[model samples]
Target: MFKNHPKGLAVLFFTEMWERFGFYTMIAIFVYYLQENFKWDQATVTNIYGIFMAGVYFTPILGGWIADNVLGYGKTIIFGAIVMGIGYAIMAIPTDNSYLVFAGLFVIAIGNGMFKANISVLVGNLYGHSEISLKDAGYNIFYMGINVGAFYAPFAAAGIKSFLMNNFGATLAQGYNAGFGIASIGMIFSLIIFTAFRKYYQQADYQSKKEVKVEKDVVLTKQQEKERIIALLTVFGIVIFFWMAFHQNGAALSLFARDYTHQFVGKFTYLLFDVVSLHAILFAIFGLAALLKKSNSSKIKSFGGIFTLAGLSLLIYKISSLPESGKISPEQFQAFNPMFIVLITPIIINYFSKLNKKGKEPSSPAKIGIGMLITAIAYVIMIIASLGLAPVYTLNGSTSAITVSPFYLIGTYFTLTIAELHLSPMGLSFVSKVAPPKMKGLLMGGWFGATATGNYLAGFVGRFYQEWELWQFFLILIVCAALASLMVVFTLKKLKSATS
Candidate 1:
């Protein structure tokens, strides 16, 4: 898989893998930790989780700016990694002070803001060579690396938490703290690997010479700068709702899993493996296959078919299995999106590459518009799922906990994953492709900043899961995403012109 890609790819791939390991590991259990340890209500916990996630994404603006103007990308990534590692370690301390935990989370968030976009910029830099024209394919490969870490985090977290709680004489809270500690271990390992490979990534280090030239040669007119800021603000506004809907994995959807889903495999052979995170493993296999298939035409086509069929089957099965009782653990449901990414990314990439070959590939803006529409559809799916389930509010405005099958959430995830494939990677690719050569790291950070804006709002939206009925909460998301999608479609021609 690394044969045609840059040597830096391996270094960055593992670095990102370990980073995600820590990040996802913490995320997998964040809500559970809040509820179980702090004894907070679901609403309070979701609110806090949303805020933390939002902050985590929000700081990238500063991180990106710093990398662009002051610190080089390499230094920024290193600083971010160290800070995140410390943050993860701090979370392991089992402190009673929520303020301290918040402080730790802030550190992690800032670090993520710095590291996430810069590293992606570095990866895109690797493809500067003519031999690898497959930037999308390359990102699909990198994304698999991300999921490899994501795939392991839940099981590792669940195992550590379960062990501590069940055997080590720790309370659920302590077990959670221990799980956070294990996540820190993953971070430390990543830091070590990154540092060791530092020499190999010398090329990824940011350069100031080009930036100096760009600054000297071109001055932005008042109107141009104003327009740029306005454009960013507009994009940010749309993203807030997108993230609010997208980030349910860590909040509402996770709670749904714990409450509604039948996690146990009942007489089904796949259940045994899936319960232990085999589903994630399947995702990894597909991701790896997608990466390797870039050079092999026959293999790409065969794998593409298999991937599409598998995703379709999963979606069908989940929809078909919707039950009246909503009792699944939402965290388990969180696995579906990444799993879907694993399955669909390759097929999407391949399909697009084929289209590109025939001069029929859609522009990035068009793809993003399509993504938003699909995201809207996903929420609609959830809204439908909510309809069959018991409504939280009745005629008297009284709320009741209704039992809805886990399938509702699963169906949403399946649809959302398809939407994610359309948007997230393409978003990253867009930033890499359009960013000025000298401003690559900073511009990439800007892309993450857009996502961060969404992430922050996602936290606030998560509160809805606690305050409103399932349908009501999901309906808001459907409308928001639909509007965003429509906006994208309306401006598609203009965006294409700008990027072109």
Candidate 2:
């Protein structure tokens, strides 16, 4: 895979990987932290989580714009990295004040916003003249780097929490704070790596100039510009629902795991690595398969088949492990979605490559539509899962917190991961493909803006999981996503024409 790729790919990949390690490590415990430390209600915590995530995506628009017209990608990324590292370190400072935590989180969100879109734009620039041919594969490989960090973060955070709590005589709440500290350490490491490789970014500089030339050369009519903006806005409106449903992995679904799943393995596995070893194993198998496929197609195919079977078997095993009462820790299940991304991305990329060769590849719009629809289906699964549990608070006088099987949340994640494969990387590739050269950074930010919108609404939806029946909340997601899918499908021909 490295043979044909740009020399700068490794530098960017590792940078992104460590950044994600910090990001996911913080997210893995964010809601729990709020509950344990601040004594906020579930609804309030979810809303905060959603808002934070939204901010993370929203700021990228500004970052991308500045990078394209003013700052340049390298400088913007460096600045963002420093800000994020400082933010994470600040979050580690033990405090009873909610304002301080929120301030730290805000800084992190701003840094993320600046960092996220520009790096992708940089990656697209790396392909230069051969962008169309290489965009999909390049994004897929880049995505694997992201998951490599995401896959490990939870385990690292969980381990740190466990160690601090057990050995240092800290309470569970203090351990949670320690986990955030560990996440900050990951950010520091990311900064070190990025700084170390500053000299190697000449390729990124060369590619950016090419991008500027391409932007300057291409001209659009007033009518075309208007149409493009309109189309982008419409797409943005639809994608918000997709994100609202998909991002539940870090909020509602995670809560479900904490309330209902069984995380214990045998003594041996637990001793060597905490029970989070299961997540590490799943990620490893998937990541290895994806990276190794370049060497042997047959081996790749064999690994793909085995991975599917293994995932299915693991799901079964997790379901079987559930106690008679259905409450489990929510964080344990959060790993599954990233694990799914690691497993499915290579297969999906290869499948599309084959389709492209056959002249049968789906349009980007079609893929987005399929993703929205799949997200709708995932919500439907969650709705069904919610039906099994009674409401903690009822309209009538009587109420109870009923235990439901963990399978519902697991099944939802399973379906949502499929949807993510269809949308996330393709969305990134689409921005690189359709965006005007001068506007690459800005448009990339726009894509993240859409995500920001979705992420903000995700908080609202997560709050619903607290007040409404879980089924009702999920049902709302299903309807929202279904409508979004339909809207995209309706405009497919127009979008295809615009891109062509």
Candidate 3:
């Protein structure tokens, strides 16, 4: 866990934690902000959300290129952080014009393109050729840091917006920028964390001959490189559908939470939901303890255990004291996926570690294919959940919203989180492992570029929500994910060969 891995992992973990905090905070409330503030319709909001998300992922190609050939990963990450901070600041400004919103999104996208793929490249660079076996585990641990941030961001958004509305008597539209302001502050914290720990990252730098051997001099046959590249791109092609389905959390899923879910809760039901959250916290604490146990250093193990227990205790104490009679909002539901990630990541890691020991571990491509299939199952759950509910928006016309149990969404998110653990982090590991050393950043960017395509497709699918029944839309996603899974499985032998 914390032992044997590069110390740079801690720096990157905290850096990504704060970055994701800001990103997910903005995401949790973004579409609502657009709709309430600008009086936009659902189709327009979903489309805009899709396009903005696409841009956020799309810029990584250029960012990765700049890092690979120009500035290197470290400087690119720092510059990207600054640019993103500026973007967040722009969004935070209390302005009546919607132009600021789009402008802020544009800037954030540019900065993210620079930051996201390159940092992942840095993470991969942390482990050497001999340590390749640990790469997936390293990514799993790093990924948990991301979820820790995502898990709590919605709470920050909800609390900030609630404070502004209640304390200042501000309208929802008027007060939304306060949430954006909180996001900006998160970015500031990220920059501080990264700067303070910047020196550690140098330990993992391949360019620094004094610290690690440079693999850049290793040569491969052109045919070998070509085969690997084709294999990587094939996996990338299939995962496009996975992201298309997975990202519906922010777009179509957000709309469902707002319009279809039974959000209103009595004290008893609220307590029940709180119990679920408490279970998640307890699981995270135990997971952290298990990870700490793997540390070679006694001090790291003891310190991590105490720190984790204390932090979890504080979280539980805070949650227990929250008033329980109010309705849960759409934004609050955003916590479920990250919460599940925190709870389950260790389990997945341990399972894979066991498989590796037994010499039965699946290749990254197979895992990704399994993930695509699992994602299809998530949509299938959604389809079943929508069985009895009348159309919120039918082709004939809009109708009264039906309040289904929150459990439907909870279940949907649960399966999707599993799919993500199997695909997303593993996808990052695959890119890092398979790509040529000199071209790592560029190919990592390619992985995210595939994600951008999928997200754009998600928005395209979302735009059709108005035209079809709820179950029908879910059916479309299921088909896409299933088909992609089949494509990946079809090419499995080739993928394994190239990766080997």
Per-candidate TM equals 0.83, 0.86, 0.91
lDDT of residue 43 for candidate 1:
64
TM-score of 3: 0.91
Give the CA lDDT, 0 to 100, for residue 62 in model 3: 88
Q: Write the per-residue lDDT of candidate 1 for residues 44-158, one digit (tens) a residue.
A: 7777886787677767767777787888788888899988988988899887799888888888888888888888877776565332237666776788678778867777777
Give one clash count per candidate, in the order shown: 22, 13, 0
The CA lDDT of each predicted structure is 0.70, 0.75, 0.83
RMSD to the hidden true structure, all candidates: 5.7, 4.9, 3.6
Model 3, 153-188: lDDT tens digits are: 888888888888989998896567888888888888
Q: What is the lDDT of residue 397 in candidate 3?
A: 31
Best prediction by lDDT: 3
Q: Say which candidate scores most in TM-score.
A: 3
Q: Pick the winner on TM-score between candidates 1 and 2.
A: 2
| Reference-based lDDT, residue 219, model 1 | 40
Point out where model 2 deviates above 4 Å. 198-201, 206-211, 215-226, 262-328, 394-402
Candidate 1 ranges beyond 4 A from true positions: 1-3, 129-133, 208-237, 263-265, 269-329, 391-402
